[model samples]
Target chain A: GQQVMQIPQYQHVQEGEDFTTYCNSSTTLSNIQWYKQRPGGHPVFLIQLVKSGEVKKQKRLTFQFGEAKKNSSLHITATQTTDVGTYFCAEGGSWGKLQFGAGTQVVVTP
Target chain B: GAGVSQTPSNKVTEKGKYVELRCDPISGHTALYWYRQSLGQGPEFLIYFQGTGAADDSGLPNDRFFAVRPEGSVSTLKIQRTERGDSAVYLCASRIQGASTGELFFGEGSRLTVL
Candidate 1:
């Protein structure tokens, strides 16, 4: 059984501040996917990291995969109200099953 | 539909009632997944359908829960003799076959509340 753990169950940041959420796994991961779920909304795909030590960026957000492929991180810079939501890291399982982390709930104050 | 579609966005029933939640995945997508999300928690895997047959249903909590994808298009999740713990947001997602590394397109989800 694979388990994904996320740190900072809740994050509160002021506008223009920077923050980071981490995801760790009990077992080595093949690929990690990031998703954002807004208030009252379903989870939406943000990005996916496959290669070890890979890093990808989406505007103000940065995603990184550890060299060991056991952990991942999402860093948001100059956070805005739009960044308020829960960020989840998921590990893909066989047959399209996903084991999702508990998530990092972010609340940005404007 | 352009994205996954779930019926009865919200449902409220008694603890002993039987409920069925339906999910219509994106057209032509060959993989479907069902997840349960409790308040303040991430989505928990429940079952997966590769086409007309279920490929993995190990995540199902008990025998009271069952799902079917008859035509490889739509799916139905049935919960018999539901309990208060059954209340949660049931999410449906779909992905194209052979794209196991691809992202999942999720529907709005069905919120179930048992009294």
Candidate 2:
């Protein structure tokens, strides 16, 4: 059974603070995807990392893929109240199957 | 429809009852997936359909859980003799042919409560 381990299952951050969550896979992955799910909402695709050592930024959020493509991380700079949600990292496999991590729940207080 | 559509949105059933959850993926999308999310957990894969055929169903928990995509557009997840542990949000997502990018457009999900 393949597993993706995520650290800091829960994180409560003050507004203007930073937050980061890391994900590691037990097996090599072809690519990884990040998703955000607001409380009481469905998951939404955020970004996907395919290349090794790849890094991508979306406004205040930064995503990084390890050189081996076996790990990834997401960092939010100067977190805001709107950033409250669960962040999930998923390893994409063949046939549209996505193995998702348990996810990191982020709570930002003003 | 503009996005994936799920029926009922919420279902409350008694233990041992049979239940059927439906998913209507985005039009023109060739890939559809079913997942279950328990409290405080991420979505777990249940099954994936590539067009009219199920390309992978290894994620299905047991024989009690079954799904079908007969026409490659709409799918139905059937649960027989449901139990309390079956309570969870069943999510459906669609993508363009399961491309390498792996971007998925998801529905709001059907929350199933087994009492």
Candidate 3:
């Protein structure tokens, strides 16, 4: 069985501060996908990292895949009010089914 | 369709009753999936359908929960003997081929409340 755990269950930060969330899994993953769920909305896929020790960037957001593919991280260079949401990491395994992480709720204030 | 669509955005039922949630995946997408999201938690996988057959259903919580995709496009998740713990948001998503790419377009989800 594969399970993913995310850190900092909740966080509150200033609009200009930086924030990051970590996701660790008990089993090796084929790929790790990140998602963001806004208030009252479904989770939206943000990025996917496949290769080990891979790092990808999307504007101000940075995503990293660990060397062992057992962990991943999402970092925002400078958080904004629009970044207020729960960040989720979904680990897709060999079965083609995805097991989602508990999610890290981020709240950015002005 | 432009995107995934789910009917009955919300459902309320009494204990022991049965409920059905419907999901219409994106057109030309061969893979459909059902997931449940409890309050303040991430979405949990319920089942994955590749074409008309269920490729993976290990995520289903119990035998009481069943799903069917007879048409290979729209799916229905049926829950029997609903209980309070069954209350959650039922989400539906679809991929191009149940594999890589397309980002898995999702619907707004059907929020179920069992009393």
Go through the candidates in order and give each one's DockQ.
0.83, 0.91, 0.67
Give the number of the best model, judged by TM-score.
1
lDDT of each residue in B1-115, candidate 1, tens digit only: 5889999899999999999999999999999999999998899999999889998998899999999999999999999999999999999999998873679999999999999
Q: Please provide, for model 3 over A35-80, each residue's C-alpha lDDT reduced to its tens digit, 9 standing for 90 to 100.
A: 9999999999999899999999999899999999989999997888
Task: Name the 10 consecutive residues with the lowest summed lDDT in model 3 chain A.
Answer: A91-100
Tens-digit lDDT string for candidate 1 (A2-74): 3999999999999999999999986799899999999999999999899999999999999999999999999
Interface RMSD of 1: 0.9
User: Residue B97, candidate 3: how far off, in angstroms?
Assistant: 1.0
Instruction: Pick the winner on TM-score between candidates 1 and 2.
Output: 1
CAPRI tier of model 2: high
Off by over 4 Å in 1: none
**The best candidate in terms of DockQ:** 2
Give the TM-score of each candidate: 0.98, 0.97, 0.96
RMSD of each: 1.1, 1.1, 1.4
Per lDDT, the best of the predicted structures is: 1
